[model samples]
Target: MDIRVKFLGGAKSVTGSKYLITVNDFHVLIDCGLFQGLKQLRLRNWDDLPVNPEKIDCIVLTHAHIDHSGYIPLLYKNGFGGKVHCTEPTLELADILLTDSAKLQEEEAEFANRKGYSKHNPAKPLYTVRDAIEALNILEAHPFDLTFRIHNQIEVRFFHAGHILGAASIELIIYSSQGIKRMVFSGDLGPMHNPLHFAPVKPPNADVLFMESTYGARRHKDVDLEKELRQLILESDKKGGCILIPAFSVGRTQLVLYYIWKIFQNMKSRPVYIDSPMAISVTHLYKSFSNYHRLESDSEFGHHIFDAPFVHYVTEQSKSKVLNTIKDRAIIISASGMATGGRVLHHLFHRLPREQDIVLFTGFLPEGTRGRDIANGEKLVKIFGEEVMINAKIHVLDGFSAHADQDELVEWSGHISEPPKMTFLIHGEKEQAEVLRERLIGRGWNVTIPDYLETFTLFDHV
Candidate 1:
């Protein structure tokens, strides 16, 4: 018997997570995510999978983030027919995200064609909404902690990773020729104290461990979240200027809303508008899956916290456009957290030049994104082929991040009952992964930092 794993993506980068595991003749792909940020990385989305999509037996999704689960639609569009197993909340959010992804693809293609900026004769979307719906049809939702068999020789269990509402860490056990082997994949561990979600579950003992190193080299700054938020809100309110926050629709958006509800419940507050339709829909799911969050009762707090009077949902495009025309003091939260694409870009185009306005970021911005450029104090940024001056006061609230920090990740990895024979550090930049490798080696753990497309034999016997 022989078993091996290959890194199709997410080796020394923060996006495009894909791993292929082969057990003799059987195959399973885990976390079929889309590449984002840099053009070189994003172009990989159009490249054919290392293995034929049709040959794959199943897809074990980690979560619903674009970088973790975005490529499912494209896979379906090509040729893949198998079960996509995930948490119930992931299924719901994926339905929304994939559809939105398809829409954005089509919109981007159309914009390129109209502006004659694309190299292609006629820009075409990689996949359509129909493809996304087709992908959504194959999703099979499972409850956490239930051991389910994907094939006669393989079994998997989903444990809470706490990065988002339905995020999970996967435990896989395979019966191979050498013997039974255990492998664990830390999908994306959450911080120790998330406001809306629970802390990540400690990983069970395994022969092989695949861990994420997204924040391996850095720790998030400890700041008074409410105080910073209050200061920004009051300053913006005083100037009669709007505060625009570019947040991820799934986890970060809801966290910001929760914080605002807590901070401004008694004081006179500005009307808060959720400008992304997908976020509006996802917030309702947060209520539906109250068991996954830190809330006591879904029914009691759902209306009070999420559906508050001050919170407004802008679902229509015309209504979203109207937000740009407004000059009053309000809090507008939009999507594509990194300002890569979405309504947030348009908000940035409108509000970035306003000295009194504020643009707040509550998430991590990858190195090549416009969000990072602005965060790094780039005075001039490009948006939609137009140069946009960055005059708006820029601020970041790292406390709202979904990924665990370096110390938190080390602490989470310490929970394994016994040290694994081999542990792979993945899902980060090369520098970040190396820093973590050194830290883990100092702790007497055997760690390997794999390169892109590298393969390793996990179990072998003759």
Candidate 2:
């Protein structure tokens, strides 16, 4: 059998992570993520895949991040009818994220049509809620470390990736007529020092490896997170202004809450409002799956970290809208971390023009995202099809990122006892991927950075 690998997405970009592995007539897809960030990349979501979705046999998910698992609904709508395999927590998280994703798209499309700002005459959502529900019905949950068979010649196992609650790096054992080979996919490895997660598990021996390079070009700065958060909060409070945090609902939001809780314990605490409904739901999962993370204990205040008196969960649209009227002494946390879409946009539309308010971002912002533009000090940002002045104090706290940095990535790669025949770096921008490729080469490992839709032969007549 001839084996080949193709990069359908996540080639030289951080978003839309999909990879296709083919062994003769059998086909398996790893990750069916949506393309985000730049307009050109987002347009790819409307384009047809080179291969028919129905032709793909199965899908294996690495995590539940939108960029990693958001495209399943669209694929299901387009004719993909295969089982989606992932860890039990991943399955649960994906259901929430995918449903939210569909709702956002539908809402955006309807708004665009009403406003007549979209180029398309009548904007339409890529997929609907029904599609997402249908796609989710096919998901098959599995536990980490248990070997399972997807095909007669292929066996699969999962290792702790430490990125999120159930994120995992996958190992595939393929048995062919000629011999046996192992292929490993390093799915979004988390930082070694993340408070909520343990360190990523080292990779077992492999003949082929695909690793993530999200932060390959730089290292995370060592800073006192508590001190920085305290200063920001104090400064905002002194100005009699609210601090708006655009954090990812999955990991970053929870981490930010933990740090804020610590800071509140030592000082006067302001009301912290979590404005995203999805984030509120995701936070509750930490309680359900105690073994998945390290936040099982209560805080020094004798309450669950998320159950503090000053912390408020906003669920209703009416309550969320009321928060827009507040102008001082509050910390509002919202979703769509990049400010691509979500309730955060409404908050941004109202607060960006206020010089006293602070808009704080807690993670990586990809190219062409509104969060990146604001963080880059753009004076004006368009919101709701209208130009809005950006007078708010903009800040980015990189220490809160969940992805592993250059040193951590190198350390993770070094855990492999022997170098693979070839290592392809995926899930990073061009410059970052190239930097990682050079670094690995210095360590006596062969590395290649694949471009979008590129294909490479892994074995011949195996």
Reference-based lDDT, each prediction: 0.90, 0.92
- Model 2 has how many clashing residue pairs? 0
- Model 2 C-alpha RMSD vs. true structure (Å) is 1.1
- lDDT score at residue 6, model 1, on the 0-100 scale: 94
Estimate, for each residue in 268-324, the C-alpha lDDT of model 1 and write its tens digit.
877899999889999889878878888765344354688788899998998999999
Top TM-score model: 2
TM-score of 1: 0.98
- Angstrom error of the Cα, residue 27, model 1: value is 0.8
Clash count, candidate 1: 0
Off by over 4 Å in 1: 298-303
Clashes of each: 0, 0
Off by over 4 Å in 2: 298-303
Best by lDDT, which number?
2
C-alpha lDDT (0 to 100) for residue 62 of candidate 2: 95
